[model samples]
Target: MTTLIVLPLLWRTRAPFTSLLCITVAGFVYLATDGPGQPLPYSPLVAIFTVAAQGGLRQRRFAIGLGLPLIAVSVAIRTNTAREYLFAFFLFTMVYVLGVLARTRQAYTEAVELRAAELEKARQAEAERAVERERARIAREMHDILSHAVSLMIVQAEAGPLVVRSDPERAEAAFDAIAGAGRDAMVQLRRMLGVLKDEPSAAGEPSTSRSPQPTLAGLEDLVGEVRRTGLPVTLAVEGRPRPLAPDVQVTVYRVVQEALTNVLRHAGATTVSVRLTWTPDDRLTVSVENDAADVPGPRVRPGPDTGGGRGLVGIRERAAAHGGTAAAGPGPGGRGYRVAVDLPVVVSSPTEVRR
Candidate 1:
């Protein structure tokens, strides 16, 4: 009766199967030598402590369950009477049950903590992606405003001397235009530098109302400035370019301007072509290709003082910021470098779409 009831408890308490077998062997020895009435009060207590130790270390419920009955059997053997044995068995079983319940509650708390840590990591990654998108939008805006101002300044600088001899009045007007362009460029440059230096979370005070946003509408003035540089640039529009976000328009214009600037400074090519196409699916493509210079020569290395090398890097950065991609390499026939950028058109709403 003792083995049948107590062994099952031992199994439940997750006692090592080998230790249970040894316990059985020891019980049989006591029965054979001193009979079933022999005192063994310590056996039940030992079993209880062993199971509690295993529960603390391994967090197994079975060890606690198996130890309970062994404790009862030990009390029954030591007390030497059925009435006292029953009383001790009841007392230990209640205590063992409470311990098991407490351990289970602790395990559940640990699992909840682990799950919370994982959720926090996921939330952080999402926030980083959002910040990257916003930074790119800001970069596109800065490029557009500054490039248009610089182009106009270049035009006014070239025209000021030509008109001075014929019409002094007009020449002074050109000089005034040059001064105004310089002030506008300085303001935009300061805004851009402030954004770069500010904390990531700080969206500083916005620029004042004086400097207007630049868009594709400003391309005419950009082409005129390139022409003033003595480079023949042909601008063509395949489809009616719809009104786009300030950032997108600026990105497209800068990509074309940077490519043409590269052609003028490095490529030494005569004729350049700039093409803009707007698709029905709200995508804009801009391409700039210049004719290859005669005679294949070794690649010219740009020095630290040169601005042409950094222009391409800046163009690529601008495109990437706007969720767009830019490619600039050798053109077809391996004759010249061609730069192209494809950007998605982002509009405000249904009303903006109709406009």
Candidate 2:
């Protein structure tokens, strides 16, 4: 009797069928040994079988198949008098109904648990994606701010000597610009490091210094810095350059900066063109092209420490984070490299912007 009661609780396991069979056999044996003079005690073996069959079998069929035999056996042997037979029938019906209800309840509970687990997994995946996006944004910002500053310093450093011979006063101004550019670079680097600190720590202390923000206004200074490199870079705007969100402006500036840097490092081109176009539809597009060098020289291999090979990779990541695309390779003329990026002018809602 105890075994029959306990079997239903274990019906979720692999041996449910075995448990059902054992409980049924035990009930029949007890019936055979105990005479009818005593009460024909009922066993919940049929309920256990009904519940086990709920694992796969149809409830109506299982109840009829199992119930009829026990009923017929009790009637034939007189182990249960007619009055007791009706009472046992009522009792077993209630037991089977309760068993089915328990099975349904258990199934519902398991389904809820599984759904909760799936939702949790999806939330975690979304969080990881957001973190990756923020890292890319910070990287693009760092490249734009630092590259602009560095380009200016390089141009000023080169001009210092030329101006020194002609006008000492102008040479001193160039040196002052170099110092200012260095300070700006350090400030930008600090801001980037601060953003990166949000990442989970694996070891020591995190840096806390913040950097100044860069916007489209900074492009003028960037252009001036590049011209200092002795490469003639022209900046043209097709549509009115309107103020943009910090991130979008930063992305535009970085795309142009990286393209120009690649021109200086690889193409050895003397003349370069940069065009920024803004439309009423809130779209921003940037194009950078440089004339092929006079004599095609050997390509300069990027060194490990310089992170030189990752420029295109970095640019692509930046464009994608802003819901835009970047294309780079050979230009239509098949002589010079052309890097272009198209970014939507509209800012996504706060909800759309991943934390």
Candidate 3:
């Protein structure tokens, strides 16, 4: 229990290389000069443990080589018979392997921590990409809402001035149409913002600010709006209509909105038809076609901002995201333009009551 025996174990962690050299030299000197009754100490293994924990493969091997010679010297000086040498050799080997195991355990812990850090970094990168994509989707939605609302309001304003002096009744009706379209736009925009704020609920559904999402059920009101703008739009529904998932309904609504907006801007057609068909095989079909108007075939192309060429691309992307299909082009005989979208529906069990 002298200071030399206990003090080396304390320095093993703080200064391992120096501690190893000191313990080896002191143990050798003690065995060379001390009396036979005094025992060789177990303190040298403490230094070996520290070196193996801190050093790499080559350093641990070198520490082991440095340690074995001290063990041999102690055995040669202390042992008097062959049996004593064998017992000393076996004991030294067992202690050496214990230090190597300590080093292996340290290396394993570090490897695990490095892998965990890499996984966290990859997860953060994926989250960033998802946010960018969501921002782009919201931008597209705002563009569609504002462009459609503004066009209807502009048409009403242009007509109100022309009829205000001659017919007070018609003037009032035109102003009313503009006011209605503006109100609807405000409500829809607020509803979209609610979706951005409201997180998913416990039921695993997106709990938005509004209760019901726009669906084919609202097609009549949309047709009415276009008719007010002087375009006679007819609506027809086919097959047994069924309720769809909220997100799918939004996509369907936007597709029809964009298609009709294109009809007002590009096709100079006075008459248009909106059709919806539901199939037993879990698909909903939407078709919009316009009759050739005073303006001949498809008009001279305008930029993407007004003509809605990019909007049709967006429609296709929405449908494809849900494993659906969309087509757009002139109708048979090249008369009017037609846009058709087919979307897959998640069919619920018949036992569930219809909302």
Residue-wise lDDT of candidate 1 within 1-355, one digit each (tens)? 3454255344535654334445545664565465555445444444444444335454335444655565556556556687877776675565555655665776788899988988888889989988987776565555555555665565566667877999898778777877876786788776667556653433565544344445677777767656654467888887755767777776776777667656544535767888887789888788999876753222122346545355667777877777878888888898777899888877742212110
Question: What's model 3's lDDT at 85?
Answer: 72
Model 2 CA deviation exceeding 4 Å by range: 1-37, 40-42, 45-63, 72-86, 116-137, 162-166, 198-212, 227-233, 240-246, 263-271, 279-283, 291-307, 329-337, 347-355
Best by TM-score: 3
Return whichever of 1 and 2 wins on lDDT. Answer: 2
lDDT per residue as tens, model 2, 184-223: 6786676566675554445655544344455566667777
The residue pairs found clashing in candidate 1 are 9-66, 12-62, 12-66, 13-62, 13-63, 13-66, 14-62, 14-63
**Model 1 whole-model lDDT (C-alpha atoms):** 0.63
Per-prediction TM-score to the true structure, in the order listed? 0.56, 0.68, 0.75
What tens digits encode model 3's per-residue C-alpha lDDT throughout 1-355? 2355456777777777678777777666666677345644567666766776765567677777866675666677767567877776676677667777877887798999999999999999999988987876887788778867877787778778878999888889989999999999998787787777776767988874465666656667777887887777888778777767767777877888888888766647868888878898878898899875666432223455674367887888888878999999997689888999999886543321111
Clashes of 2: 1
The better-scoring model by lDDT among 2 and 3 is: 3
Q: Output the better candidate (1/2) by TM-score.
A: 2
